[model samples]
Target: MDFKLEFGITDEGKLILADEISPDTCRFWDTKTGKKLDKDRFRRDLGSVEEAYQEVLFRLLGIN
Candidate 1:
């Protein structure tokens, strides 16, 4: 599941966006394979945890 990226205007008229849009805030998964692609991997002792985080960052940054 993905967290909502909510935007709001504060009482002082300041713009704010809640949520980091990172794996820490989202429970991503490899849908077809049913692999956990978030921090749960680390907690569950699954390999490739770093790669999973990197994948999320790469996608967020639009990097190849």
Candidate 2:
């Protein structure tokens, strides 16, 4: 559930939200198993990195 957000100031001094929110840029875990389903898999040298990302996509978009 942890994520990162970026902010930027415009020429008119207006604060704007920047940056993309995705599995590649944030941490996602399974509530039941506490399994990582983000980029951390690749960082930790865990196998099935592709499957992890696909799981996220399926959970979000209901796709297989």
Candidate 3:
């Protein structure tokens, strides 16, 4: 299954995972530098984001 996760950075730059997940959405940056991150080319460069999410889930679950 595909899902989305929101990660928030703390005041000290620590990353925290929020407790919500959605399937029909992913993340995007709304700035020039963010644009430079090439999110729009993600599908071409990294396949679907859903595939990436599955890899992450595999690591998180110690499945491989």
Candidate 4:
């Protein structure tokens, strides 16, 4: 599921929400295989890192 946390400061001297959300900010995994599909791939040298980022971009663009 997608999530965005909003944060900001109100004139009343209260903290508020400022939007924050992105594919890169979170880790994703294949539930069936338990494979990491996030930055871990790059960190662990698991390969397919470019494809993974491109996949996220393509899917975000709704290009199947």
**Candidate no. 4 TM-score:** 0.54
In candidate 3, list every pair of residues with a backbone clash.
none
Regions of model 3 farther than 4 Å from truth:
1-45
Q: Give the runs in model 4 whose Cα sits over 4 Å from its true position.
A: 1-6, 10-20, 57-64
lDDT of 1 by residue, 1-64 (tens): 6665878899999999965777877899877788888998989989788898987778778997
* Tens-digit lDDT track of model 4 for 1-64: 3344767888898997666455466676667777666676889888787777776678679998
Q: Report the C-alpha lDDT of model 2 over 7-51, residue by residue, as the tens digit.
A: 999999999998888887789999999999998988898768889
lDDT, candidate 3, at 45: 75
Q: lDDT score of model 2?
A: 0.90
lDDT of 4 at 46: 81
Reference-based lDDT, each prediction? 0.82, 0.90, 0.52, 0.70
Q: Which ten residues in a row have the lowest lDDT in candidate 4?
A: 17-26
- Model 3: per-residue Cα lDDT over 30-63, one tens digit each: 2444331223336557456555566446655899
Q: Give the range of the ten consecutive residues with the poorest summed lDDT in model 3.
A: 30-39
Q: How many backbone clashes can be found in candidate 4?
A: 6
Highest TM-score: give the candidate number.
2
Off by over 4 Å in 2: none
Give per-residue lDDT, candidate 1, residue 41: 91
TM-score of each: 0.64, 0.84, 0.33, 0.54
